[model samples]
Target chain A: EPEVTQTPSHQVTQMGQEVILRCVPISNHLYFYWYRQILGQKVEFLVSFYNNEISEKSEIFDDQFSVERPDGSNFTLKIRSTKLEDSAMYFCASSIMMGDPYFGPGTRLTVT
Target chain B: SQQGEEDPQALSIQEGENATMNCSYKTSINNLQWYRQNSGRGLVHLILIRSNEREKHSGRLRVTLDTSKKSSSLLITASRAADTASYFCATDNGSGYSTLTFGKGTMLLVSP
Candidate 1:
């Protein structure tokens, strides 16, 4: 079965540095989303994209965060400046017209 | 308040046994989904129960949704050691391209 795939399975960056987490969603899926989970916390919604634009976002998705589908298959999350608390597992998911979303293996972002 | 909150944060069982996890949400939801995550890995889509549906099953996994009560349960029968993982419940509003709200998840350990 086709699945969402993410690059740089593990990323380590210095605090205040910019970082980009990339994902290649299933080719046919239309809706894309980004979520994050702290080491021992709930998965928090960051943003959702559809029709090549952001459809919804959470409070945590502040100015520091931005998402782009630079190409047909690539969906990326960019963090302008990383903070210690920004360290977490970031997941990319995609679905077919509000259907069940398939999540990627996730990118573990560690900011020190 | 969180949208989805799972109870019995941790559970332990042996192979061939059954495991049940429960989730409660604070508001109306269009659908409820269950996901499994291996230690430090990705979220695997398990099942989804819609607001109009009361029960759904896939393989040995059974899920029931009580829309009136705003609760859902996931049951894994005749489980194996490979079933050991953290299970999460995510809620989605019916709006188009909406984001998912995820719970803290339940950690299940199935010993061989």
Candidate 2:
């Protein structure tokens, strides 16, 4: 079965540096989303995009965070200036419709 | 928070035993899905139970939903050592589009 895939399985960056996490969603999927999981916390929704614009977002998705589908299959999440608290497992998910979403192997981001 | 809450944060069982996890959510949901994550790995799509469906089965896994109770349960029968992982229940708050809230997952250890 086709699955979502992400690059740079693990990322380590200095505090205040910019970091971009990349994902390639399933080819036919239309809705894209980003979620994060702190080491021992629940998964938190960051943002969702469809029709080339953001459909919904959570408070956790603040000014420093942005998402872009630069091309057909690539969805990227960019953090303008990373903070130490930004370390977490970031997941990318996609779905053809509004129901179940297929998730990708997450990218673990660590800012020191 | 629209996120679900799972009980028994951790569980341990013999390889041949059955493992059960329960999830409870606060608001209305369009669908509920269960995913598994191995240590430091990806989220694996397990099973999805829709608002209209009461129970679903796939191989050794079974899931049941109670909309009125706003609760769901996942059962893994005849589990193996490979089943050791964290099981998460994710809910899509509504049907219009895709934004999910996930619970803090239950960690299961299947010992051989």
Candidate 3:
């Protein structure tokens, strides 16, 4: 089965540095999403994208965060400046119908 | 309050036994989905139960949704040690292409 793929499985960055997490969703999928899970906590929604624009976003998705579909296959999430609290497992997901999302293996972001 | 709060945060069962996990949501949802995650891994989609559907089954996993009560349950019958993982319930409040709210998840350990 086709699955979402993310690059840089693990990233370590300084608190003031920027980090960009990349994902390639299933080729035919139309809806894409980003979510994060802090250690031992619930997975929190960050943002959703469809029709080349953000459909929805959570309060946690502040100015520091931005998502781009720079190409037909790549969906990237960039953090302007990392924060210690921003360290978490970030998962990228996509779906043809949006109701059933297939997730990628996730990128573990560690900011010191 | 949490949107999708699952009960009995942890469970342990012997091989061949059955395990049940319950999830309750605070608001109306378009659909509810179940996902499984092994330690330090990404989520694996298990099943989805729509708001209009009461029950759904896939393989050994059975999911039931009660929109009136705003509750859902996941049953894993004839469990195996490999079934050990964290199970989470996520709810999409919109009918399509929307953000999902997830719960803390239930950690289940099946010993052989």
Clashing pairs in 2: none
Q: Interface Cα RMSD per model, in Å?
A: 1.0, 0.9, 1.1
TM-score of each: 0.97, 0.97, 0.98
lDDT per residue as tens, model 3, A23-96: 99999999999999998999999999999999988899999999999989999999999999999999999999
Q: Is candidate 1 or candidate 2 better by DockQ?
A: 2
Per-residue lDDT value at B28 in model 2? 89
TM-score of chain B of each: 0.97, 0.96, 0.97
Angstrom error at residue A98, model 3: 2.7
In Å, residue A59's CA in model 1 sits off its true spot by 0.6
Rate residue B105 of model 2 by lDDT.
Answer: 93
Tens digit per residue, CA lDDT, model 2, B36-80? 999888889899999999999999999999999999999999999
Off by over 4 Å in 1: none
Angstrom error of the Cα, residue B46, model 1: value is 0.5
Candidate 2 error regions (>4 Å): none
Tens digits of per-residue lDDT, candidate 3, B29-73, equal: 999999999998999999999899999999999999999999999
Candidate 1's error at A56, in angstroms? Answer: 0.8
Query: lDDT: which candidate is best?
Result: 3
